[model samples]
Target chain A: MNKTTKSNFITYGMVIAAYVIMQILVGTGSVSSLLKGLLVPLCIYVVLALSLNLTVGIMGELSLGHAGFMCVGAFSSAVFSVVTVDTITNVAVRFTLAIIIGAIVAAIFGIILGIPVLRLRGDYLAIVTLAFGEIVKNFINVVYLGIDKNGFHFSMKDSVSLNMEEGSKVIINGAQGITGTPKNATFTIGIVIILISLFVILNLINSRSGRAIMAIRDNRIAAESVGINITKYKLMAFTISASIAGVAGVLYAHNLSTLTALPKNFGYNMSIMILVFVVLGGIGNMRGSIIAAVLLTLLPELLRGLNDYRMLIYAIVLIVMMLFNWSPKAREFRDKYSLKRLFSKKNAQKEEA
Target chain B: MSFISYLINGISLGSIYALIALGYTMVYGIAKMLNFAHGDIIMIGGFTLFVVMNTLGLPPLVAVLIAIAICTALGVIIEKVAYKPLRQASPLAVLITAIGVSYLLQNVALLIFGANTKLFTSVVTVPAISLAEGQINISGETTVTIIASIIIMIGLMLFIKKSKAGQAMLAVSEDKGAAELMGINVNATITLTFAIGSALAAIAGALLCSAYPTLTPYTGAMPGIKAFVAAVFGGIGSIPGAFIGGILLGIIENLSKAYISSQMADAIVFAVLIVVLLVKPTGILGKKINEKV
Candidate 1:
């Protein structure tokens, strides 16, 4: 427990330090425009990685719908921003409201999807989560929403029949998606959100409920026999994880001027990418997740000069990282370089004695 | 008449899914790994055919043979290089590695082919089958797909039931250690399973591209995932279950698209899996294994 907390502190320190350095670079005009464009996305990915790790790493359920929650958040927040754009002239206030709405909407969805899904275990849970993502993606494509003097109207057929008055606006344009969203999301907001997520996740990881969640992950049957309410705990972790992903979604939505719920952007590939972050980061390691998300998010962009070879290199990195992390030789090397051995040599010798 | 056409379309599509699901079920049954890269092999096969026939100007049949050969060899190599070392690793680790292999295949394809859809010419040429006084017509590709799949299924069944190598596959899947003790050559059996699975993927890819008439880098992704769902729905390790599940899922998806909202078809198909699993967690033909604490 002490070690865990200490590691969390170290992680927090590293993240804050990196944030400070990045901010300094940006302020001094030392950063490139390409990197500046990546800042918000980098933060969003970090949050996604952290939240996904909560369920996959701590809760031990592989959810393939983290992006679905993000989808909910993105669309919801975008809609909120659009609806209130005329009334709320202040971008900051509207953006905050958008984030809050997005998080709540996503949490509700998480509960709705999680209740039935959490009943299953392992691979079954994974497939169900995958289905949930597909359902969300497909659902968005056919849905049309508009707001008029009579209030909000929705349809599945065509966006033209949203029943809005002449002065009213179409919020969701079916497959065309929500446009003219206020791009008020800045890099600083993203960093702050990332910090807030880290703080909540870290504190939760050290809390009693967090222990219960981990206990359930370690052994579901044993945890249930010991009187841990599996449903409540699983729901807690899953919902919180979903909400955080929603927060990331809000961040992402506001970063862009137009938000679309396209399969390419919010589908299996995106979900899998987030899962890759969690898995490659050493599931359950928050610091590692943050690092992996940041590094991997930057990698493709860094390799953009190579054009087509960027993704190829990314794929190679994925394979190599997996091998290094999981292979027996790598494990032996990790053991050799472990901080415990370096820091506690006297204790180790005493134990040997 | 339209209904019959839809049914034919669904059946043809389902057969392709079944072909792919067979490989998935076989690999899962024997290797006990998800082989997430299996779908990508379908893309590789299609791309190979496109290259051989379009670029190299080879005959369609010879192009298909080359594609099958490439996929089979690639599948064996993947198992040997990526999955072999991780046999003793945790399920999560192996799953991630499988995903990595999938990413590798996709990105490699993306780099080579770009993201644009490539038009693929139909390889099989047969007369359309008309029924009900021409009210219903099944395309030549659909007819050929259904018949070829049926023949393949029968041939695979016979091989598994009557062939020595097939028995070795069964034994290995049943108990790898025990199979090794019985001199079944477990690794060889696994390599053979991957080889056969990849070959099936090649056929499925050819039929799918010809039916759809467009091949993109990600053309196999949706089908791959849907096939995985079918594999699970039928019971992950059950051959007949995968077969039945694939056809049923295909029919359900198409019928839903025709009768209900076209947009909701994919969701409805997935919903069926969820409903089925809720009632029967191990799936339709899945055997219940006791959990060890």
Candidate 2:
């Protein structure tokens, strides 16, 4: 096998091995349950941050509504898992079906949203996506398919007919959130899914299509001159990124079991928080995004003991990180330890041998 | 009667949106970059007013002036720290940095203020005013919003039309490189632009807080997005267009919520934006220019 193929295999193998080891530890009761809970969310967020990096970092598109895609996945999977009684009989079947359904539903919404808005550039695209995100959240909150005596009935479809008199069924429960989702998401499952997502994205980034998308990000005009179809690639990035975000959403819903009643989690702030993770990790660097996502997610939990000052310390860290990058002294220090030379030295030694 | 009041309420709300949109349009006109944190500046202005009025026990007018002064300084600092260094960076870099600054300001506010709502009573209370139609009464607060917005709009127009600095601002907006060649301090001019934009945002915040006393750390996000929509709806860089667009958006949103379902109001507004963009990308009052090769 070629060296590149061998390295790719090794990376995948290592990731799978790490996941398996974590599972064994969790199963054996070696790791704390709190730590395990933290790992589940961290794994989901890594998928989210990395998926978002595909659009915002790699493709140079500013999509402010990624969480909306996640919402679609969460709701879709929640509804499907709740309705499907047979899948619960087998754990493997249930997991596979939920993921497949979540990814598919998210991809569909991604395409639907991407078609019109992807044509816009930069700030315009950002604003459009931001609006779309709000629209999705509100739509989910208000749109009721029917009313029944039992509760409110909600359908994923745009229109549904129901008898209005007996009792009202509000599908989304208005300000109230979806509840009673099957709690099948475990640390092992979350880690496996995250690893699979990372593998897919990494593979895509190294491929020719990925290069074309990155080229478009660097300079749309140049990429277009080189015969790249900008619209197609942008749509591709949006759809794929959105689908992965959907997977994260499904994992989140199942893990939490009870979704928050408030629209608090699906707002612009959440989107911005995810974007911060991407930026903090260093955009366009998958490893950076993964590390940043994990660290930032854990940082607050780690500092929970600090009580009122937890958020204060968190804000300080964020500000200091931004200021440090912008400071000239930091730049000089960064230049001294440039990774380019370090990697090049190893390559040169291998060539000499 | 309550529904009619809500209609009037929507119009007054739209005026505040118009006020904020002016700053967005003016900055975008000159810099060609959306000041993503413009809304947070408004939030800061509101908090400044709260501190001045509530904590310091200053009179409303004096407190407003203090708030404006602080916001103007904050605006200038933001421009210098976050934007000036990246003036020539790719649009994406500037955009990211703007978002960073936005988050920085928000988290700072959250850290300092806590997440609970803050009450600014000075802006919220006013006796109701009777209209000519005895059945149609208007709140004194709504009247103040309408009058204040008009006065501010006219004052800005006169300043842009007659003042030297305003003329220079217009020139810079027209052609930055050319204006610089003619001996304008582009950097200082840009700072002034941010300061003016921020001051207007402060006023809008103060007025909005009068109408709605509840202020949270995240209060700015939706208003900021709405103001941005107003800017885009009117024309990204058109000052007058932003004012008109903001009012129109406010009216449309309010009326739709009152006449139809409130839940669909957001969707309707976005649908309108999408249609406007498809029909006229440059916006209602914006001028279209061919992209440079």
> Which structure among the candidates has the greatest DockQ?
1
How large is the C-alpha RMSD of every model relative to the true structure?
2.8, 4.2
Query: lDDT, candidate 1, residue A265?
Result: 77
Q: What is the lDDT of residue B142 in candidate 1?
A: 93
Q: Report the Cα interface RMSD of each model, rounded to 1 decimal.
A: 1.8, 3.3
Candidate 1 lands at a TM-score of 0.94
Query: Which DockQ value does candidate 2 get?
Result: 0.40
The number of the candidate with the highest lDDT is 1
- Name the runs in model 1 displaced over 4 angstroms: A329-353
TM-score of chain A, model 2? 0.82
- Best by the TM-score measure: 1
TM-score of chain A of 1: 0.91
Backbone clashes in candidate 2 total: 12
Q: What C-alpha lDDT values do all the predictions have?
A: 0.88, 0.80
DockQ of each: 0.57, 0.40
Pairs in clash, predicted candidate 1: none
